[model samples]
Target: MIESPGILYSIGAFLLVIGPLVFVHEMGHYLVARWFGTKVEKFSIGFGREIAGWTDKRGTRWKIGWMPLGGYVQFAGDLNAASQPDPNAGDASAEERAALFQFKPVGQRFLIILAGPMINFLFAIILFMGIFATYGQAQNAPVVSAIMEGSVADQAGFELGDEISAVDGRAIDRFDELADIVRLRPGQQMQFDILRDGRELSITAVTADVTVEDRFGNEARIGRLGVQSAVLEMETLGALQLPGAALTQTLSSLEMITVGLGQIISGRRSIEELGGPLRIAQFSGQTASLGLYAFLFFMAAISINLGFINLLPIPMLDGGHLVFYAAEAIRRRPIKPEAQEWAFRMGLAVLLSFMLMVTVIDLGSFGLWERLSGLIS
Candidate 1:
């Protein structure tokens, strides 16, 4: 059973993960709208009550909210549900009512909508780079520490303390090469050349099948030869290595997101794997158990997920708004007010349903219901 996380760490983790992501996302809209001469009504992080706020020079209300789930930037003339439609929008008859969001040009609206997700992507990239700057890449060098008896190496008659000199007759300069060579070819026989006590010994070993479960609970059939390599020598980044590390980290995350999407579509993953708020809290607690660095790493991963998910072209999302903007640009007109309102309603329903479904999965995944069932039974 998973233990509950420390309250302070859990709260800190939530703030760390959500705050910057929302800030960047909202800032994207705020900056773009400003550039286009659009008046932003308010910039808010979270919902419900306001915690801290100030009217900016532009008269935009900058606020931190009590609820930390997500945020929004309300542009003037945003008389609709931000992206929804309202025929009565920005119509000032009797008193003071300047242009709200609806009055913005198609080009300006395009940039405003695009800004939110772009900022998220940029934030992820920066985080990845920051992580890399702190921890340099793993440098692989072959070092044999110990071998388990009755394992693959043992069955193959390979001796302990044998330095892997080559794999499949290929010369191995570094220890890391063995992992990919082994992992990619499951249930296949492989040749190994090891430096056993300074004597070259060649042997054949059959790779084993391993099941890998990712954070999303998607399992993969992987190849394993049951060989353990000594941990790579830790690295300390010099001045020149920081930028490279960050770039690599960001690219790696993007690749991972691609792989995840493909797997979901290919029937290799379950839709139940999608996680909502519950899972974030679960991960927060789990990471807190591993200490500060681990928690921060988890925070980075969640930030990336938030960024990517927001970019999906779903209605009620930043991406969805961008889609509408594109349509408006092509048609040279706003989507009809009624059409936009109906679209918002549809989008809202779909998003809410998805959230509810994922929350159920999250609760079950965490075993909270399981524990309760056991207690009841």
Candidate 2:
């Protein structure tokens, strides 16, 4: 669907964005396992046949696989890359058994499994902090500068110079936060609390759904309340203040995503907008074209999404592993191997089906089928 230079550009951008994130995630697991005295058998970046690799002094086979979609770290005593304990690990030499991942205390095992996602979150925080410290944040107070004539804001009696205090009971400090909330709930009623003339008043209005096209020609419908901010302000974070600002910004993004997901689940938004690798590649290339700051912000966002997705309680994922560990903790033993295998199979099936659906959506978005039809004619 993507042709020539565009295809090559997308591939390069995708690799650059995903490779470092995957490496950071696996490194978290590898480092924590080593800390718990477990031997890592392999540290891999990607899957399938090895393209290139070398052994470390610690005897771990570090390799890059042909498929660059995802990666894993295999621990000694694991049957495969999924970290299933080797059935014969029990019969291993006492010395070898000492370094077996399964032999570790449950707490240490839990920590090792958790370290991967935790590191992803930490990486996002660091990236955000660095960006904020370097470039600072561009912000604007949520003060109404103008009310669109005969629009929702005008109908709701929104006046110029009114500072927004809250939306739907959620306190908003900046104009962007107000925009974020309003954009997701098109045609829905919203309650706005504003401070005007030193008096606070609440106004209720229904948002207007506006269809917009992005630079990539993707169409999306978002809500607009028709009130503009009075003035834009650039707020610079001091070195000492960077951490707090970064954390706040990162958490806000996460919360916004969570709310967006909820809206989709509630049928307030279209699930057809769900995307897969193709969509991700498109975004990667587009962001890279916007220069370094934009690319770094995009990477931070992807890292946060990765961390959150990995924390979902689906088997074959980090969260699923955590669930098993939790069960083992309560029962004083691991779940039956047969049961674990079945859970993983189901999880794999669900993931694959979702991937296929999103891939189809991506192709449709790219007009791949339409182009092929035109060629046939």
Candidate 3:
């Protein structure tokens, strides 16, 4: 049986991981709004009723909410956390009207909305920079040290010493890159460029689709290459190289997220693979148990995901707001309030439904469904 972290530890780790991320994300919006001379009414670390809070000198209420799922920043002249323009926004006095976010120029408003996700990405890069500056980067050559017997690689005529040079025309410099490419293309046929005994050759193989369960009982489906690296190496980077390296790592992570999302949308991957707060908590606990470095790495990856997800063009997201601003910039006027309100309502419903679906998936990952079935039977 796989051992799991205690409930208390998981909850604590979850908060440690999430609290700062949410703060950073919301702070992005707050700072940008303030820079544009807009008033930020509230900065919250989560949704729902306030657990503890204090009003700042600027009259912004800083608070922690009971629900730890997500957070928002409420600005002046906004209907709520979604930042919808207030119907009474035009009724404000001159002094208050000047500070209202709704009255800001389209360019300023776009930046204010864009800042949140941009900051998340920046935060992830910073975390990665720290990690590289301290522990360096872990990597291995793309040489096939071993291939599983009768597996896809083996059937594709992969030799033990064959070195992978590329995958489908994309250059592969490291084992991790090759692994990442294969992992995202489960059950799909891929062309591989390899060097076998100093001779260049190409091989085609279909990656095996496999379901893997972590110690915490959370499951994920990934493509398996059935090959191993002979040696793992850590390359230390100088201070000057750290930033670039970190940015590359962040972009690589962002690419993986986008690919996974595309697969889900295209029906190539299962919606059951989507995770919610429960899975995040479990992952937090598991990574924390591994060590500080492990936890930080996990945090950075999740931060990237948070940034990317918010940039989706779906309503109620940062991307959706940007879309509105884009239209305003072109048309030389704001979209109709009635139309905006309807879009927001639709967006809220989509978001709520998504949350519910992921929550159900999270519960199933914990064997809730199996236990319930057994009980019923």
Global lDDT of each model? 0.72, 0.88, 0.91
List ranges where model 3 is wrong by over 4 Å.
215-217
Point to the candidate with the largest lDDT.
Answer: 3
Candidate 2 regions off by >4 Å?
1-5, 372-377
Which scores greater on lDDT, model 2 or model 3? Answer: 3
Q: What local lDDT score does residue 369 receive in model 1, on the 0 to 100 scale?
A: 86
Give lDDT: candidate 3, residue 333: 100
Residue 136: error of model 2 in Å?
1.6
lDDT, candidate 2, 321-353, per-residue tens: 899999999999999889988898898898888
At residue 132, candidate 1 shows an lDDT of: 54
Error at 322, model 1, angstroms: 1.1
Against the correct fold, how does model 1 do in TM-score?
0.74
Number of the top-ranking candidate, with TM-score as the measure: 3
Candidate 1 local lDDT, residue 216: 40
